[model samples]
Structures are given as structure tokens and as C-alpha cells.
Target chain A: MKMEALVHLVSAIYVVSVLLGTHGPVYGRLVSVNDKPDPKNAAATARWLVSQNSWGVLNTISSELGGAPFGNVVSFSDGEPGKGSGIPYFYLTTLDPTARNALKDHRASLTISEYPIGTCGKVDPENPTCAKITLTGKLKVANGGPKEEIFAKNALFSKHPEMKDWPKDHNFEFFKLDIEDIFLIDWFGGPKPLTVDQYLQAKL
Target chain B: MKMEALVHLVSAIYVVSVLLGTHGPVYGRLVSVNDKPDPKNAAATARWLVSQNSWGVLNTISSELGGAPFGNVVSFSDGEPGKGSGIPYFYLTTLDPTARNALKDHRASLTISEYPIGTCGKVDPENPTCAKITLTGKLKVANGGPKEEIFAKNALFSKHPEMKDWPKDHNFEFFKLDIEDIFLIDWFGGPKPLTVDQYLQAKL
Candidate 1:
């Protein structure tokens, strides 16, 4: 009986530790860039990459160039972070050919953000908090290998199950991004950049 | 004098036509990419590039992960559609090195969204509605050039004169991004991936 009790306590502590240790969603900013990749900045670069690929609310201005309103909640993803086997990857899905073409050109960036549900105000569109991390990076169609494709598909489906029934080639395509920078903004202040490693550490 | 008046009327008409025609903003969706730049899908690539260089709000989800929130405006100067001389660029200033590093690696894939006022929700920390378009692209640190540095300075100072007094190269740096893709979402659900040209034609 004592042994069983001890086992339960250990298990509980382990679970709590894991939960506490793993960082929640972190806000980041994209500040500067280098023409080529630098190993010395690997930690920062990695954190930005993860943040960019992660999910958040995406916004755009009106088309009339006048008083058009902003849009909300588009899906996005950043892959799992780590070295060697499981590096994080991110992607988005759109039916527009222009967007498709742009993604193919490796010209895409993202602002991954998180809010305390009520931070943005009421869930209504009229008044809401628009706090998030904007990650600037390039977008490329995921065309690596069967294994890579599988991983991409799984990652996407995990986030958005509604996409499961879509045609394999149609709504589904892998988008890999090299995180160039991150821009983090809280409603309290202004937007700024964050390093990839810092973002990752925040997540952890 | 009558002939001069006629000329003035013609010129006024032309000016009004241009204002009415080119007054609005463009919208579209960006493509996705990974580490290497993919050349196969040029259109998607372009959209992605536009998205990467854009700006948005930032939010924090956890404390363990050094998450901070901020809000800032980013400006872009892609040539006026027809003029091919200008590429898109924006201004970013932050004291965070992590954010700066992220912008450097994946400069190609970022998103910048633009929109009119009231398009976004109110500035309520809970509910907000601000409309704008986003672009994703690569970031380049300005190194005192006629074209690069000048453009960056002009855009930043024009919109944000408050920063004019900021120290040079301390916490502020002029950065230029080569847009790869762009995503413009009006939220009216008219059509996806609206081109800048198409948007102009619609106004006419």
C-alpha cells in the first residue's frame, strides 16, 4: 500500500513538472536580418522559426482603401521544434492561386500570437484584442519526400481536422518557411522582434 | 483664359481619376515555404514575400517563456504597381536581440497586412476591429545607401515622426524587405487572392 502511494505521488509530480517546464505560447518580434544564415545566431533563429510557423489570428486591411474593416482567424501552423530529427515546420492553406503562387515563391511571413481569451475584449468582431507575434519568413511548397509530406500532413491535420477530407493535391500542400525574423506586440506597448531560440525556450 | 480654364479642368479630372483609381489598398493570400527558396511557383512566392515583411499585434501566453506584447505600424514601398524601381520595405526597432535574429534568417517568408482605419476593431484590450492587409518577405538591414537607407528613413519618418529623435543605430535600425508573397483579406468574402491590378480595375 505504501509503495502504491509513493508511485502515485511521483507520477503526479512528474506530470506537474513537465507541464510547468514546457513554456506556453510566447510573443516574439522580427527585427533585423542577414543575407545568409549564421550559426552563431542559431538559437535566436530557431525560436523565430517556431513562432512564425505557430498559429494565430491573421488580419488584413479593407480593399476600398477607405474604411473597410479587418478580417479574422485564419489557420496557420509551425512545426515541432528541436534539432536533428524533429525540427519545427509551419504551413497555411488557401484556395487562391495568387496565394498559392506566392507560397511557392517562398515569399511569406507569419505573426504567431496568443491571448488570454478575454484580453482582446469580447469575442465579438466589433471589439477584440489583436495581440500577436509577427514572424517574417519565406514560404515554399513542401515537396521534399514521402516522409516529409507525411509529417506535414499530420501536423496540419492535428490542428485543423476539417481539412481531412480535402483532395490530397488541392487544399493540401506543405509550406516550409525559413524564419527570418519575429515581431512581438502586446496591447500594452508596441511591436518588436524576438529570436527563434527565445521563442522556443518560451514554449518549453 | 478660357483655354487655360479648360486645361485646368482636364488636369483636375486626371488628378481626380488617379485619386479615385489608386486610392484603395490591395489584398491576397501568401504562399508557404521552408528553408530553401523554391522558384517553381513564382506567384505564390511573391505573395509569401509580401506577407513576411508586414506587421501585426503581439500577445503572450505564458510567463516561463519571456513573452511580451506590443503594437506597432509597419510601412511598405513597393513601386506604384507600374513603376518597377521600388521593392517593398518596412521599419522595425526593438531592443530584443532574439526578435532581431529571427527576422534575419527567414527574411523571405513574412507577412505584412495593410488596411484602412475602423477596419480594425477598437483598441479595446478585449475587443478590437482594425482593418488592414498583410505581406511576408525578407528583411535587409540598411547600410547607408542612397536607395535602401533613404527609402527606409522616409517611410518611417513620414508615418511616425515621434521616432525622429531616436538615437541612430542604438535600438533602431532601418530594414528593407524584398517581398515574396502577399495576402490581402477584406473579410467580405467576395473572392480570395485579389490582385493589386484586379483591385484597381474594380475601382474603375
Candidate 2:
């Protein structure tokens, strides 16, 4: 094959392999890019990270642990698959300290790493180039009536089907991070100066 | 071939495939288990998590964000390779808020999820069967003798080789979570009742 044709064939095979990997359902959703957005496009890169991940560390102030910062592993969704709104919605129960902590003090942050997305390749998770975002804001329970609840549920259940069957007795309720500050590190130098508005408005 | 013989052959092939998959140096290090320990072994399970994971969300009280719990994606190690002491060590610099926060309050937590280990199978990350651990306590800079620094560096560099090459001008120093509490959920009715003593004493 000609060099140009060979390059096209290789790229096609790579895309096909990634698509095949996404069949796992619970993880491995295809982002808009086969790789990732350029670090300079802060909003797009941040949105892509949130859209592609299914779980992250949700931080809350712990009343039980003498008001210490507590981080918990929780599954989250920005929206149903590719239609991410960039506002992470979570299903949390008061039984867990994270939700309980949030009820008392709304100040929280959700930290998501690109490592688990399988796009960081061999880079260290702490490496600035690997990309990490901490969306700091209020952790508010969804009390915006039935319409909002429906949207949150659809957004969550579409990605995590098992969440729908979590014991009803647990009283799991919808919660969201009302993003106020965005701290994103995608490359060397320092955090990209991104606003909540830019992140929410970014075309993913 | 006999049915038992065929089953054994398949199992061997499965093990070989997992070993082959672990060739990626940065992310895919082989843990002690071909499968995770029984969830009933809380101490053992927690130790396994700390030993196996190289990175997790390190939470700290952010002075900049009005004492909000700030969780950052960071790489860590408990000890050198198979000799994990179950006391998580870190390489941090004051340029990062996490280290500065630790210097002020010393309260922190490190949360690790088993989902990334690839041994969770198809289980949802939030599911109790998939396992998660949070070590809550003081985040102290390693002020011990030169021997302690060497131990911490060896522990970190063995698991994260690239960490050794991180810029010297960054002024990275060793730190460890002086764990006072242990929270683990493997196959849980709730958080496992493992104590720090049990976690530190458990044999990996």
C-alpha cells in the first residue's frame, strides 16, 4: 500500500479497536476525540474529562471526623452518554458520611483524574500533563421539583444501570455540585484559568 | 481432554493474560492477588488496597477555599514494592495547595478504589462488592532521620519510577498520612470496621 493509504488504514483500525473497547458499557465510553483536546482549550478538555469518566472522589467536610476533609469513591454522571451538561449529578444516601457531611456543610469538591479514563497512557496520575480537575462548589440536594429529579435520574441511570436498583430503603437522593470554582491542570506551568460559565457552555 | 483438565488449562491462560496485561510499567503493576481477598478480612482487604494502588484522591482542608475539603489526584506508595508498610507515603511540594494545607491543619484522608485494579470484573465502582478504602488522619511531612527519607523515597520511586525524575527545582519532599482511622467497603453492608492498628499490622 502507498504510505498515505497505509496511514489511513492504521488510523481506521485504531478507531475500530477503541469502539470495540467501549462495548463493556460500565466503563470505556468514547469521548469526542480518539485522544484528548489540546491543553490550551481548557474548557473543552475539562468537559471531555468529566464526560468520559463514570466515577470520581467526592469531597465533603466530615462532622464525624472532627470536621476533617473526607473523600469518598462515588459514581457520577454529567449527563446521558455524549449529552453531558458538565454539571455532575450523584445519587447519595445519608447513611454515608459524604452525603451526611454535605447536608450540614455544602462546601465540597469533586476530583476526577484522566488516568482512569485510560487516555493518560503511561503518565503518572500526578503528572500535570495527565489532566486533573477539581470542581469546587456547593453540594446541594436536588429539590428543584419532579422535572429536575427525572433529568438527574436519566442522566445517572443511562450510564450506571445498577444504580436504579439500589435498595429503596436506603433513601438515595439526587445531589449535584453547584460549580463555583474550576481548578484544572492539563499541562505544565499551572492550572488553566477556566470559569464555571466557560466549562458549562463548552461544546463537548 | 477431560473437563477438569480443560478448566485448568483455561484458568492458566487467564492468569497468563493478566500477567501479559501488566507489562505497562506506569499503571499495570501486578498486585499480590490474582483476585482480591475475601471482603470479610477487613484488615487484609484494606492493606491489599493500600499496597496495590499507586494513586488516589488526597483530601485536605483548603485554606484558599474557606476550609472546603479539597481532593486532588495524586500518586502515592505505602512501601517499596511487595514490602508495603500500610502507611501511605507521598512526594509533595508547597507549590501545591495539598502540601500547604497539610502544613496548616495536618488533617487529611487518602481514598482508593478497587475499580482501577481491573480485578473488579464488571461490577460498578459504587457497588459494595467492588471495594474502596479511605485512610483518614494527619498528613505530616516526614521529619524522621535520613533513613526514613530513604525508605519513603524508595517506596514511592519503586512504584512510580517517573516520580524520581520529577524536576528538582519543584522542591518535592516526602510526606505520609499518619492514619488514625480506616474505612473500607468491599462486600459491605456498610463501611468495614477495620481500625488503624489492624490495618498497619495486617500482613500483605
Candidate 3:
């Protein structure tokens, strides 16, 4: 095949491979991208990191541990599939200290890394270019009304199907961060200057 | 080959493939493991998560962000390859908020997930059985003596080779979490009760 045609064929195959790798209901619905975003676009890049990542470390002030900042691994979603709203919602059980801690202090943060998405490749996780976002805010149980609960359920179950099958005895409740600050590091200089307004307004 | 020999051959091939995937000098040197420890061995399990993971979300009280628990993705090492001391050390630069946060407030935690180690298989990241560890303690700059710095260098550079070459202008320094509390979940029920003494004394 000619060079130009060969390049096109390779690109098509790559796209097909990605589609084939993403399987099951949870992986099937969401959009997955490995492209590194331009560091200049702080809001877009920040939202992109949050939307693309499936899980992150949820930080909470542990009253039981003498007020230490305790981070726990968790699966989260901003919305269902490609329709991310730039606000992360989680399904947590009080059995977990994260939920217990939040119940007491409410101060928390969710940190997501771009390295897991295969976009960073060889960059060190600590490297600023690898991209990490910490959404700092108040952690609270979602509104009990059907309107918000339904949205939270769809947002979580659509991305993490296993969560739906989790034992009902766990008393899993929907929790969300009332984002008060955004700290996003996507490039070398420092953390990106992103605000809650800019992040929520960014077009996916 | 006999049937038994063929089975062994296939297993060998699988192991070799894993080694090939984890590259670079640092990754090459570390003894990687994916087997989940028994929930009963809370201390060992906690140490295993720290030893096996090269990076995790380091949480700290962010003074700049109104004292919210700030979590940042960072590369860390507990000790040189196979000799993990159960104390997580980091190579942090003040350009990052985490290091800055630690400078002001020492209260912190390092959270790691077993999902990345490929042992959890199809389990959801947040599933209790998937295993997660949160070492809550004080984040402090390492002692400025040659003895400690050398150990920190060897431990860090051995697992994350790129760190040795990080820009000097960035002023990356060695830091370690003074683990005071251990919260580990390797199976169902809830967080395992593990003390700092138990974790530090656990046999690998």
C-alpha cells in the first residue's frame, strides 16, 4: 500500500482496537480518550481529567485519626457517559471512613490522575505534565429527592455497573463535593489557574 | 512437551510478558507482585500495597485552599525494592501544592489501590474486596543528614528512575510520611484495625 493510504489504514485500525477493548455496559457507555490536552486550556484540561478518569483518591479529614487528611480510593462519575457535568458524584457507604469522616467534617477533596488513562505514557506520576486535579470542597450526602438521587444513580451505575449489584446491606448513599476550589496541574510551570465557574462552563 | 510441562511453559510466558511491560531501569529492578494478601494480615497487606505501588494520591491539608484536604498524585517508595520499611517517602518539589501544603501542615495520608496491580481482576475499584490502604500520618521533610538522604535517594531512584534526572532548578526534596495510623481494607466488612507498630513490624 502507498504511504498515505497505509497511514489512514493504521489510524482506522487503531480506532477499531480502542472500540474493541472497551467492553461491557459500564465501559461501553462512556467516552475514553488518551490524547493529552493543551496545558494552556486550564478549564478544559481540568474537566477533561475529571471526566476521563474512572476513580481517584477521595481525601477527607479523619477525626478518628487525629484530624489527619485521609485519602481513600474511590470510583466516581460526573455524569452518565459522555455527558459529564464537571461535578463528581460518588456512591459511598458509611462503613467506609471517608463517608464517616465527611459526616463529621465535610471538608474534602477528590484527586484524579491522567496517568491511568495512558496519556502520560512515560512521564513520572509526580511530573507536573502528567496532569492531576484536586477538587477541594465540602463533601455531603446528595439530596434525598428523586430528582438528584436519580441523576446520581444513573451517573454512577452507568460508569460503574458493579456498583449497582453491590450488596444493598452496605447502605450505599450518593455523595457529592460542593466544589469550593479547583487545583489542576497539567504542565510544568505550576497548578493551572482554574476556578469552579470556568471548569463547569468548559465545553467537553 | 508433556501436558504438565506445557502448562508450566504457558505460565512462564505470562510472567515474562508482565516483566516486559514494566520497563525502564527503576521498574525493572523492583519485585512486582499482584497477589492479594489475606485480610487477617492487616499490617502485611498495608505494607504490601505501599511497597508494590509506585504512585498514589498524597493527601494534605491545603492552607492555600482554605485547609481543605488536598490530594495530589505523586510517586513514592517505602524502601529499596524488596526491603520496604512501611514508611512512604516522596520526591516532592514546592512547585506542587502537596509539598507546599505539607510545609505548612504536617497532617497527611498516602492512599493506594490494588486495582492498578491487576490483582482485583474485574472487581470495581471501590469494592472493599479490591483492597485499599490509607496511611494517615504527618508529612515531614526528611532529616537533612547524609544517612537518611542516601536511603531516600536509593529507595526513590530505584523504583522511579526518572526522579534522579529531575531538574535541579525545581528543588525536589525527599519527604516521608510519619505514619501514625493505618486504615486497610483487603476484604469485606469494613476497615481493618491496624496500628503503626503492627504495620512497621509486619514480616514481608
Highest DockQ model number: 2
Cα lDDT tens digits for candidate 1, A144-194: 899888877666555444446545554555666555456554432334345
- The CA root-mean-square deviation of candidate 1, after full C-alpha superposition on the true structure, stands at 20.0
For model 2 the local lDDT of residue B93 reads 92
Q: Interface RMSD (Å), each candidate? A: 21.5, 4.7, 4.8
Q: Clashing pairs in model 2?
A: none
> What DockQ does candidate 1 have relative to the true complex?
0.02
Query: lDDT at A155 for candidate 2?
Result: 90
For model 3, how does the per-residue alpha-carbon lDDT over B1-204 read when each residue is reduced to its tens digit? 354554445445445544555333334223334454677888888888888888899999888877788898889998887888888899988977888889999999999998766566456788778789888888999996999999999999988888988999989999999988887889887888888888899988
- Candidate 1 vs 3: which has more DockQ: 3
DockQ of candidates 1 onward, in order?
Answer: 0.02, 0.47, 0.43
Cα lDDT of all candidates, in order?
0.38, 0.86, 0.81
Cα TM-score per model: 0.35, 0.90, 0.87
TM-score of chain A of 2: 0.87
Error of 2 at B185 (Å): 0.6
Residue-level lDDT of model 2, residues B3-114, one tens digit each, is: 4554455445435544554234653355534547888899988988888888999999999998989999999998877788999999999988899999999999999999
Candidate of highest TM-score: 2
lDDT of 2 by residue, A76-172 (tens): 9989887899999999999899999999999999999998887776578888998999999999998899988998999999999999899999999
Provide chain B TM-scores across all predictions: 0.44, 0.88, 0.87
Model 2 ranges off by over 4 Å = A1-24, A31-35, B1-23, B31-33
